[model samples]
Target: MNHTPVEGFSKLSKQEKIDWLLQEYLENNQDFKKVLEQYYNEDADLQKLHDEFSENTISNFYMPYGIAPNFLIDGKLLALPMAVEESSVVAAASKSAKFWLNKGGFKTTIINTEKLGHTHFILNVEPHKVLHFFNFKLKKKLLEATEAITKNMRNRGGGILNIKLIDKTADLENYFQLKASFGTADSMGANFINSCLEQFGKTLKEEVSKEESFTEEEKNSLQIVMNILSNFTPNCIVRAEVSCKIEDLKDDSGISNEDFAWKFKQAVTIAEIEPYRATTHNKGVMNGVDAVVIATGNDFRATEACAHAYAAKSGKYKSLTHCTTDNEIFRFWIDLPISVGVVGGLTNLHPLVKFSLSLLGKPSAQELMSILAVSGLAQNFAALRSLITTGIQKGHMKMHLLNILNQLGATEDEKKYFVNYFKDKTVSHHEVIDEFNKMRNL
Candidate 1:
């Protein structure tokens, strides 16, 4: 079937939009409309709010919201809210949290809280002249131009920290950058930073145009390329760590405490040195981190981007987590660079997000960063523990048992039976299906 693209799709109402989608893409299937409408919010106001979150909204895509209790971070016990669909993530985090609870839990330190952005422009002026203006006159003008924008932030002990002029003519013809650092306080300051960068861009053109030091040709050559906030916040860092006596690391994994400690350390070392291992290792860490991030209405994409970049900061992709076993002590930790906000974006609008923040004790931005780092650390520990012990498939497949049962169309009684049956036996897709077929035949 040939489908023509429809114009003015955004101008249509919600039902009209769905009708167009069904006719063009879904062949006007009534069942598709039912499926879309089934997930719509019953409250008209809430549904409208959801629709306005993005364009051409037909329905809501939902993920399971779960809580992992028993997290002890910085001497405070709290339950973490996680939003995800994958199996075993929440369970693994909770298990790790409980394991380390009595062993002094997770300790975190805020290393830095600086975010940055850049204003890119091009000017055909001499490098020395550009530097002189930036140092003496342009910097002040840029700061002065942003005073109104930074006022409330400064009142709250956060604002523009410093501005630097970086020459990039070697990379491109007459290219330059105004690198600005910021402190955002309790919010992820994307809008604030971008606003300031745009002002800087305007100030750059204006100041360079009026400068008597520059010729008319040089002044006209000035072009403001773009102004944007960078998601790669390396200085916005938090460190989460857990440590205990190696002798106390004994578990039912049939391995000695000393052996387990050394093996764990070796696994982390392999990830640190090998790129292949590090990719999967860090993915497990993000499984925990992203869950909490989504639950709290923060930007997971930015968090993920910053983390992977930080991992490869040494010119090679390595593990974000580190482990050490020395002097009869075992330590595991991660220095995560992530930016999150508790008082902005969807925090005030989304009902569940509000509940999630309150559930976390209404933490500040710094506290949220620590929680995110700890979640990543706990997830890494859980994955490594399973990997070094009974193997990952054992626990992961057990958690996956119900999904398999549902796929096989097992009844409630059959599901109950398989739950007990797989308790001791190994679970494989073919074996479960074969056994299920046999039970049905019998």
Candidate 2:
């Protein structure tokens, strides 16, 4: 699909860029497939993956939230859907990306993905061949366990795509691993696969029969490492890109494109070398990625853990993404495992989550992944532009005005006045109090 081409790149004006993007998204946003109800039917796997089981208080109330607007992704413009409550984040992302839009808008793309998953069980036994027992006899059982998961995935044109076993550091003395692969369909598949593993594990631990004299010691030797979801998701990899042109900044207060570019680079540089800064930088990345993940009912914790873990994999925590420029065109890129899906998940549960998923319509896993990649890029652009331009405090302070206004016991109109007033001034708490007193006296 041809897009408006990140406006200011060649010779387009910032308004020209935003106009083209808004027009393009309005045209395409309606045709997508969207599912709003959880239609449960018998399948080999799905019944367990989205298991609400008995009511658990924790998940019962973590409803979907919003990130507000001002970001666009893949071939669409979005206010950027988010399910978080950290006050400044959504506004910060909106403010930053809006700033970039005036410089020609963000350009982004998402690449396809491949996957691998592991199920490790640590069993320390007197005999050495306990781990070896499965190699010869469990082949059929492994296939049976895996095959049980294929029906749902296959219906959607994917299934037990592959399977393998991994050995964690054997030198660690008591560690071992068992891993399996099941094509996740258009969902994260954590529940689907975990249920299969749990049921099969019960079968594995149970005696083949009472006819065979299997000792209690043998049964007790088994130890479950984790029969839950995995953070080492490689099946999905998302890559995104965003760029703007020097001419896009013509309307900025007084900064040059080259200066803003340098400033943005310096801010990213801090994130690269400093862990303290990197966490925030990476948080900005997740600020975009996690919102969409939660809206679809996928696990946000796993995505968060894996994302930062990936950024710090080099031992020195650094940026999960990098920004670049070629003469007049500035660009941003990020690659990370964002395991997510729309089927067999909470995407079908909870009133609002299901509603949010429907609002997005039905998107293929890869297609949805592409959308996420673009959000990440737009979010990163938002953060960098703020740092380089008027600085972080400008937009942050505007969103923060509400918190302070509430504290001052301002009426609704008074709060609105304060927010506009706060947007127009340099910030300090005393300044807020002073403004409050002036308004109250009036």
The sequence of per-residue lDDT tens digits that candidate 2 reaches over residues 373-431 is: 66676677777777777787776676677777788788998877776776668666778
Q: What is candidate 1's CA lDDT for residue 380? A: 94
The lDDT values for all models are 0.94, 0.64
Find the number of clashing residue pairs for candidate 2.
Answer: 11
Q: Each candidate: RMSD to true structure?
A: 1.1, 16.0
Best by TM-score: 1
lDDT of 2 at 205: 54
Local distance difference test, candidate 2: 0.64
**Cα misplacement distance, residue 22 of candidate 2 (Å):** 51
The residue-by-residue lDDT of candidate 1 on 265-379, one tens digit each, is 9999999999999999999999999999999999999999999999999999999999888788899999999999998899999999999999999999999999999999999
